[model samples]
Target: MIFLSMLRLMVHDGFSLTDATPYRHLVSGLQYLSLTCPDISFTVKKLSQFMHSPSKTHCQALKRLLHYLKCTISFGPHLCRHPSHHLYAFFDADWAGDRDDRKSKTGYVVYLGGNLIS
Candidate 1:
């Protein structure tokens, strides 16, 4: 699930539309999974935007995400028992990065004692 920074997904990229049922189901489940697997949160969010009418490319991306998850099933965040009192936050924004909609995208993550909290 390595998304290139320059990759831009469009609603109509000449690829045929795919069945929405399975895509919707997988995206929904991935939404829940994102709670524990923050690494895929951004990808899942991007994929969910096409739920109403997912293109073949979107379906392929979803499959690739699933494969990545399968291969990294054993990896997960570990919380320390005795965490430090330090709190850290980081964020970045892509100004008008969405080529299709020209909308800016931003994301942030918060950590407490080196453990991701948000």
Candidate 2:
């Protein structure tokens, strides 16, 4: 209720939350928020862990997220429309990287349509 009212106030007063979801923009927001708003970092990081099944706490964290969005509403990705189309990818892994479970850290990305699909 308070969050919705605050956001209504922000939007009515000309603020918005449209540009905060792009990958790079989100990373930057988290970084800035981590440093400038340490009070929210732990909440935000825990939210990241459950990105798949976000809880009410996660929703609250996101509502609070508007502060950062309100502050950085101007930010977004800038991509050249005429970049090369040749696809390229790099993979990395540290075998048995997890000391506790002896699990590996594997990563890969596929660029099929000018976007990282995997």
Candidate 3:
């Protein structure tokens, strides 16, 4: 689920709209998956935005995300038995990254003893 940094999904991409039921259903499941799959949290968050009116492009992105999940099904955070005392935090933000709303998007991850905690 490596989205292009320059990729910008809009509410209206000139593509035909699709049924929202499946999209909403899948996105909802992905929200739960994001709890363990931090790698997909940002992608799931982005896709969740269009659950109300998913277009063809949005559906395609969702499908790609599904495929990515299928391919990485075995990947997830693993807790260490002998956890270290060190704590680290990393974050990134895009200034006005949302093309539809011109809002900033920021994300952060916290790690304790080399294991993701947030």
Candidate 4:
């Protein structure tokens, strides 16, 4: 759904789907995908490095991603209503975790009033 949403956005802006493939713009695109489809963020980011030179396997993987989106259309995040207004956050990082680049992975999520807005 995340990729599809990006595809939708570009198409809505009058760009042809094929030509709109923004593999060249993975950083921003993947960040948007993280927000729109948090469940797939990790996997999406893992695959992002190959954007500049995507292989047939990558194309097939993207197609599978689209299929997963279609199958899970009804799933979505739900923020419960509550009276508390406290803000809470959780974060984790693994330094030099990427096998290929030895770059660290940083992940975080914040909640305000029991709602995760970031």
Best by lDDT: 1
Off by over 4 Å in 4: 1-28, 88-111, 116-118
Q: Rank by TM-score, descending?
A: 1, 3, 4, 2
lDDT of 3 by residue, 23-95 (tens): 8888999999888777888888988887778888888888888888899887766787655778899999999
* Model 1 ranges with Cα > 4 A deviation: 78-118
Candidate 1 residue-wise lDDT, 28-111, digit = tens:
999999988878889889889888788888888888889989999988777776548788999999999999999999999898
**lDDT for model 4:** 0.63
Worst 10 residues of 1 by lDDT: 1-10
Over the stretch 22-116, how does candidate 2's per-residue lDDT look in tens digits? Answer: 43345446766766555456545644553444344444456567665577666543345546576768799999989999999998876644655
Higher-lDDT candidate of 1 and 3: 1
What C-alpha root-mean-square deviation, in Å, does candidate 3 show against the real structure?
6.8
lDDT of 2: 0.53
Query: What are the models' TM-scores?
Result: 0.62, 0.37, 0.62, 0.46
Q: List the residue pairs that clash in candidate 1.
A: none
Where in model 3 is the C-alpha error above 4 Å?
Answer: 5-7, 77-118
Q: List per-prediction Cα lDDT, in the order shown.
A: 0.83, 0.53, 0.82, 0.63
